[model samples]
Target: MGKTTGFMEYDRKTAEERDPRTRIGDWNEYQLPMAEAELRKQGARCMDCGTPFCHTGILIDGKDSGCPLYNLIPEWNDLVYRGRWKEALERLLHTNNFPEFTGRVCPAPCEGACTVAINDPAVAIKSIEREIIDRGFAEGWIVPEPPQTRTGKRVAIIGSGPAGLAAADQLNRAGHTVSVYERDDRIGGLLMYGIPNMKLEKSLVDRRVNLLREEGIAFVTNTEIGNDITMEQLQNDYDAVIVCTGAQKHRELPIEGRKLDGIHLAMPYLTQSTKALLDANYEANINATGKDVIVIGGGDTGADCVATALRQRCNSVVQFGRHPRQPDERSEDNPWPEYPFVFTLDYAYEEATAQFGRDPRQYSIITKRIVGDENGHVKELHTVEAEKIPAENGGYTFRDIPGSEKVWPTQLVLLAIGFEGAEDSILVGSDLEHKRRKVKAEYGQYTTNLEGVFAAGDVRRGQSLIVWAIHEGREAARECDRYLMGTTRLP
Candidate 1:
């Protein structure tokens, strides 16, 4: 939908990042701005394939295949290629509630499924998207547009993460009085605290939140639903209650010495670091300065831990991943139209590599146990290198090699394994049905057993991408509006 032969003429380019060595000193965003001409060239890389799968918004074999938000990717790419910035912004905002957040954090399945990716590099959709929204804000084209009429229906969304925020935005625009409740003192949940500031600046989150407030969404911070207020109270006051609390119950490693003093979950560590940056009077409870750190997981969270430890001036850092390294190119099992499983260096890893003179990730490693000093602080970590074995169920499992046992000295251990699901504490004394530790609700319906209560995002779907959370939030808002007004115009 861009130039007729643009895909053949132009090469794919992405936003350049700040120098890793210098950027590690602070918490500022790492990505540098791309020039308009280059960004337009990136937009022009979009091909005129008859079936554009970039916005298919589907999951193939339980993996994200395209933009879950179903963004009008080709249309906006064409607009950007033509220098129609305002039109591009309109198209972008038409589907995405917060382009800025998704542009920065979303693992763009759209690019993985791009038609151009079949034979060549994919279009730089994420980079173009970030530029469009950033330019829109800079040009004063983006502003608060509160609904003119109120429906007299109220919605209470629990959680200020991407999902909750998206639902609130949609409901508020549909003329419903929406109040977002966050347990944390700040408005944004995962955006504000779960993620580090270097990846997504707190100011950007504050900017959008301020805009949301101007557009008539009430925000209640430092309030817990079941504690500060009761579920019954919200049900009585609001027409609908949407549970977007997210899957915050972090998975734990139950190995020996897990209860050591220096060991911590990844979220709490990230939260404390961010809190310290925001509050001058506060100091981070867990400091890694001059200490040997070992992160036990290889996901984005683990990489963030590695980066954070480096910024804290740790003596040395290493990350352990259960899975082996991914291939440089897509494997046979992972084909086109599915999110490509390939190895690429993320921002955090780049920074760690630059600072340490080597990558901090150690693959195919399983932690046997932690060893504590006499004072009960982490003193060493025992691990074993494992190999992946094909299981009878067509899945893979790890088996430890007998002679690969090793030990590493460390003072701090961070577990970034993953999340289990929604916290059990959030559901206490409530009749909410749960499946696999997640709130039970159908995907499109999003309704709970209760008449007026609904659930969405990670709370309902388990741990997923930010784009999927936004998609669920928007869909849930539509369903809630329909239940309230007997009809809904929300897309």
Candidate 2:
């Protein structure tokens, strides 16, 4: 509340982006940062609402609404408006551990739940968030706030993704020596390898990791729980164990020609593409250069695949989805204050439309089979229109329409149907039992069948957002701390 009338005085503004035609030529960040003055104006737009619903991280209609990390949105916005950036960074760091990562990649739920969004555009929360953290890094304000005293308790957090990192951060702040074990060659787990670099620069991830290392946190890389060091040994070594290994298993297309050479799971394809871009693809690289590519599933992962493929210079690219295209306007059933189920173009779609002369999305379509060449390579894809019938339960049922089959030239087929759960190989090897393939832990507690072992993040709750992962990790940290010490104070 720098100015009493600031919300009315300023229009919401955000980061700009280069057009697809120009940005697709290089594998760099397309989201252009907003000028400082504009960012300040956007920050000033935060009204001094007495009950700021933006930070009220509560459940809405059974869905996790608002900021899961409960960021001090209005406080920081006002601080930025008053030119007190350092103070704003402190407020921002009050809850969130990594604002830099969420600032870039997260589809901000806070803005969606903003109180100002009743009629006007929502405040540019994400942009201001990114600016605050970047300012912290540039001004050297970000430091490792290691715990003051040791509790003589040890904890092992498997998987260094958002969840594992948050759990470790909280436990470390509680004066417990935390050791993060990552199966990957590097830390940050999905943030390090799964996500494309352009959307979120790896430098930001590395910067936080470096700071964590400076704080005396021991990071053991390439050491899996069941494989490298058996879970039995982990329990014997540590007082408590937290399973934060995210869901790595991908859903598959159980159709003909599924064993074709050019077909790949979304995670592997995305992971390989990121590796090629950073590590430089070698002899047998999975390059989409000058190839016809079709990405299945029209979610963010699919869009990321399209963007990555375009950057790799794919000749033609398209994405297909099974459900009917969403409507442009929200229906009466979906009134205000609810997450709108309206069709809107995302960044990837915008880029593809600009580069490829049309939107890459084809809705209400289902892939029947993968048409492959004689030598066991995917050549083309066969698809059919999915007809919909209104469901008595207030939804719709899909049926394969007749005489609507078609094929698209596809040298590469990336399946992005989303992940199911974490790989059970390690869990089973650890002799941990599970419910629905997830670690069978009682609600409100992350305890597993094996004593002194717990699970969190996608591994515990299935595939979820980074914010939820962070929350679960923090909660699990408290439980683990309480288990080690009869009483705990860390939150």
Candidate 3:
């Protein structure tokens, strides 16, 4: 409990956002800082409940019900309310390895499960977490604390994403000589290249990487394990190996004109943009400048593509979702305390509406084909309207509406339809068991079929949130430590 009557005395107030029109001109993070006093008031809004569900991570109806990291939401909220930011940061770090990353990008399932959210707005947990970490860095309270002694044991972590980074951090803290290998030129894996700078600035990732380096954790970039090096070499060089290679296999659309010049996958486009930004080169081969862009897919990646195209000064933009639009409010089946599948305006949606004077999303639409010009470049996209067909079994299917075809002239098409699983190249000769495209490992054990080899994050659990990746990474590191030292003192 933050305050006896704090919930009744204060209302939730989150950080302000930069104007969408102006923010679309730059790649920097668009969120403005929240005043310390105002943030304290928001923290005071946390209710005194017997059992706060916000910190209980559970899966209900195949959806997240609370924070996956099992963050100490009430403790931190009370700390923030009492102006104990240093203590709040310490509490946040107890469960989450990187509050900066999750505070910026995580969808905040904790808020949905808040007891107060049943009737009123949830506590601003994510904003408070972000503020605590940012203040810690600004005040120089966050410093690299290397282990006291070396254990003479070495561990190798593949894929430098959140999961790999979390594992590396834990293993290094346990006095083990840890080395992380990344195929990308820079560390931070997807954090470095996958996400756009607007949502999460690159400088933040670089800052953490520098701290990790100063703490004696070795980072090897531009060297992949299975390709540049071999699995046998990894096994021979290290005491144990943990594969955190995330699911990078992008789903593709096998429709007409799929091989056109102007059509590209979302990851490559986003990666190229970030790389070009870092290298001070704006002329990317897959740029969307002066083109009419059509982004297919309705997930976060698709929204990111739309925002990128807008920043690139595309002439026009449109997004398509295969399923119909959801209700503005929660439906009967989606009750409180469960992640609500409702329609909400995201940053890209707001920007598109502001710039174009209308929402760019067209629900219940399916792309039939991609039309190309004589130059063999994407020129237009053909789509058909979808109609919902109800069945007696309380299920439904989508049927294409007849005579509802439409086409739009466009030059760039980005497929942001999500990912399947880990790439096959890395797992080609590995004697690891798998389910579907993901490596098979028990939830808590994190052990693969092969001895001394483990898998975690999206590679084992499929596509998931950054918090889950961090949790898996930490758990996998503990298992690896136990395997090497016969026991682990790590949390």
Q: Return the top candidate by lDDT.
A: 1
Stretches > 4 Å off in candidate 3: 281-283, 389-396
RMSD of each: 0.8, 1.8, 1.4
Candidate 2 is scored at a TM of 0.95
What's the lDDT for all of these models? 0.93, 0.84, 0.91
Q: Evaluated with TM-score, which candidate comes out highest? A: 1
- Report the candidate with higher lDDT, 2 versus 3: 3
On lDDT, the stronger of 1 and 3 is 1
Off by over 4 Å in 1: none
Candidate 3 structure quality by residue, lDDT tens digits, 1-491:
68878778888888899999999999989888899998888888888889899989888977888988899999999998899999999999899988889989988999999998888888888899899999999999999999999999999999899999999999999999999999989999889999999999999999999999999999998997767898888988898999999999999899988999999999999999999999985567899899999999998999999999999999999999988899988889998789778898898999999899988898999899988889998899999999988878888888999999998999999999999998886667476788788999999999988779899999998999898899999999999999999999987
> Model 1, 63-177: lDDT tens per residue?
8899989999999999999999999999999999999999999999999999999999999999999999999999999999999999999999999999999999999999999
Q: By TM-score, how accurate is candidate 3?
A: 0.98
What TM-score does each of the candidates earn? 0.99, 0.95, 0.98
**Could you give candidate 2's per-residue lDDT for residues 1-491 as a string of tens digits?**
65678779988878888877898887787788778788889888887777777777666665556787889898899888888999999999888889999899887778877767867778899999999999898898877767678878888889999999998988888888889999877899989888888888888788898888777678999888888898989899999999989888888889998899988877777777776666754332476889998999988899999988888889988999988889877677665555556798887888888887899999999898888888989999999999888999987888999999998988988899988787866667788887666777764688888889988888888887888888788888888888888878866
Clash pairs for candidate 1: none
RMSD of 1: 0.8
